[model samples]
Target chain A: MAINKIVASVEEAVADVHDGAVILVGGFGNIWNAPSYLLTAISKLPVKNLTVVSNSGGFGIEIWGGVFGVHEHDVEVLHRTKQCTKHIVSAPTNPLVVNTLETRYRAGEVEVEMCAQGTLAERVRAGRAGLGGILTPTGVGIPEIQRDKPVIEIDDRKYLVEKAIKGDFALIRAHKADRWGNLVYKGTSRTFNATMAGAARVTIAEVDEIVELGELDPEAIVTPGIYVNRVVLRQ
Target chain B: MTEKFRIDDQTMALRVAKEFKDGDVVNLGIGVPTLASNFIPGDREVIFHAENGVLGYGNICTAGEGSYDLLNAGGQPVEPRPGMSILDHAESFCVIRGGWLDWTVLGGLQVSEKGDLANWMVPEKKIGTIGGAMDLAFGAKKVIVVMPHNTKNGGYKIVKECTYPITGFRCVDLVVTDIAVIEVTPEGMVLKEVAPTWTPEEVQQLTEPRLIIAPDLHEIELA
Candidate 1:
């Protein structure tokens, strides 16, 4: 694993991604988000039908680029969209995540999976912790959501299966990163970045500014060096 | 000084809304509480906070003025004010935790005699999570509840004890309902004023529990 964290641009960072691979993108409604430059890159490239791992299905599709179609077309929108959906899987209850579903799901083009935000946090935690699958009592019933249908019996108590989320490519936004590839965020930016890095096979970050490796505080650095494959500077 | 202080659900919602004051940071919980923002005097600044992480929420967005990407916690297209700020989810919680909120107007299933609030969760249903209702109930300096006086079948909502899960400790300060305005104190839901055409005895009779009467109740100032 040649962990050369610094790359020239987001395009070079995500150039390896081919069409049809699932990519986990970081950001909430385009704020403190993974570098969109890659999306800009893929927009022109041959890649299509991208499976994006994100809080919502939002991108230029909802605004700016008229690609709000992606918000409708995401096969697995991690949050609820306006597409009018039901909880098929355990989903995040966080309002922001739910709003995404309310908007895109009602459009009837996307499928929304409802998972707990804490569960998403924990699952990503498991990926970082190097575990196969972690179990919990998050989503049990309402009977409509049918993931892990087998009612696994644990001491007469029933539990549902929550599968781990692993992505082929991890995209993240960092406030600062060094040329050697250490990253930092201005505030509570660590919410999804660390877990996203762990869950993805090739993690790519688009940082506001790139610096040297030792330029960052060893303690302040959230995602460690092992998980990050490459870092690219954002415009 | 005998002017009747009666306001139905809508007026109660709009009139008590005067307390928001200009430029005051306010968080409107779901439902009727959400309507209070509409009543807020718009000429001056009254910033609204929706826990889903949008600050400086604006009123009725015109067509084409709304951003598909910009949304309220409820996921509706809302006009971002001139001074709007977007925040991350966890950081939004921090603003609530840091006591940055001025007032939180919440809608409740019930307001107990002790001012306890039961707004966020419904036991056994398992539908929605208690997003920052608990935080706002206790975090905001002032907690105001706006609700209907009676249920559909004419049952009262102001009760002796909450028969539901609670979002915060005994923390509700003022309640503006269709029938009356009540203040939640340690002494229980003391009747602060009577709605027009309704007597204290009539209001008490309609209530499930005997709400306490303040020694000196008066009419709403009607802001």
Candidate 2:
């Protein structure tokens, strides 16, 4: 039988995600580009002890107004449902307010690995590229960011070694996709989604619209179909 | 209410914007630094770099005119200029980590006399987030802190030493606050400009580090 990438629903898309899974949610800038349908579907399923990686730690009640409604992203909903075991993120705040992650962290209910926003992005990209790691000077002298990481000096300049971060599954969002799984992102919603397309064992995309093959302009394609294992059209 | 010889946010931003040279590339932090873009003079074409990925965005977008898709690093929707380009997270950080920023204006909780920045977290708060603070502080050619002279609880922010977690060590070059503009030099904090109504001695009382008054100390003017 020929492989068909399209899935019936968000629940079916995330159905294979087991407990203790490491999920990387793509997109930044609130939930405008986040895979909200996939996130909401995951929130309803019986999963726990998950490790979530993203740009910000997650969203809170504050940023519920965007392209999507107030259902919340997988990161925030995972924390709310006590399903997340840890988070490796750059900005962990809920933007303007204290969030469940903060409370859970303080209460020792979850673990967090704080990283620089850029380093976080690069590390994820490195994972997708199959590189060993990234050497950056951004967090050289800072103690908290260094976190006992190795610092090597090249040409008398110092750089910290940050390992690549791959995930079991990468949840991404795209503005448009062709039946072949070619993706095109719109505006700033293309933040981390493009880099995360091929960085995981399984890459799933929740797109606003899916067009017929040959409909998307070849030059506008951001993520090719080979990287994506499944495609779910947003309900 | 009695006059406190204090400046508003816009005035503070104006003072900081004057520091940028023509054709400089700058990264503005979330709060007070966000206002500096509005005060950049028309004659000087300073490029504003938002970490989330727009290179040449001009100003904050009014609510009715913007979609959630065109936002700055602060997550506020903004308008892109004539030469704006969008990049992904990896490429955006390449701009930051490559030392392309000529000036980075950041807000601080405390700045030590030794130029250590403690801005990402409050000690009492159990959970805190350090977004791009470390990266900007480490890679920018010059880091200028823009914040209030004192905490909301009336404690001095420029201290001999910081009690909270440090963001970057000896990275701050200048600090623009509500009451005064100070520079972090090898010797100590140099008092450069003050509010018109405040005296040097009065500003000293609010500051914790010993002030080295500059020979050309003058009042801050916003034009």
Q: Give all candidates' CA lDDT scores.
A: 0.61, 0.85
Question: Could you tell me which 10 consecutive residues in candidate 1 chain A have the lowest summed lDDT?
Answer: A75-84
Which portions of model 2 miss their true places by more than 4 Å? Answer: A1-4, A61-74, B1-3
> Per-residue lDDT of A80-197 in model 1, one digit per residue for the tens?
2221223322222333333454345444544545444434444555665677655544344423332555556698755556567777777776778765556676433444554566
What CAPRI-style quality would you assign to candidate 2?
A: medium
- Candidate 2 — what's its lDDT? 0.85
Estimate, for each residue in B1-223, the C-alpha lDDT of model 2 and write its tens digit.
Answer: 2249689888888898898887889999888798788887667788998777778778787766776788887777887778788888788878887889998989999999989899888878855777778888888889999988998877889999998888888999999998899999999999998997988898899899999999999998676
Please, what are the lDDT tens digits per residue for candidate 2 over residues A150-194? 999999999999999999999999988876778988778888898
TM-score for chain A, candidates 1 onward in order? 0.73, 0.94
- Model 1, range B24-128, lDDT digits (tens) per residue? 888876566766666766587888887656688787465557764455544455766788765544446556656788888888878887787776444554444
What's the CA error at residue A50 for candidate 2, in Å?
A: 0.5
Runs with alpha carbons beyond 4 Å of true place in candidate 1 = A1-235, B1-10, B62-65, B124-127, B215-222
- Deviation in Å, model 2, residue A179 alpha carbon: 2.1
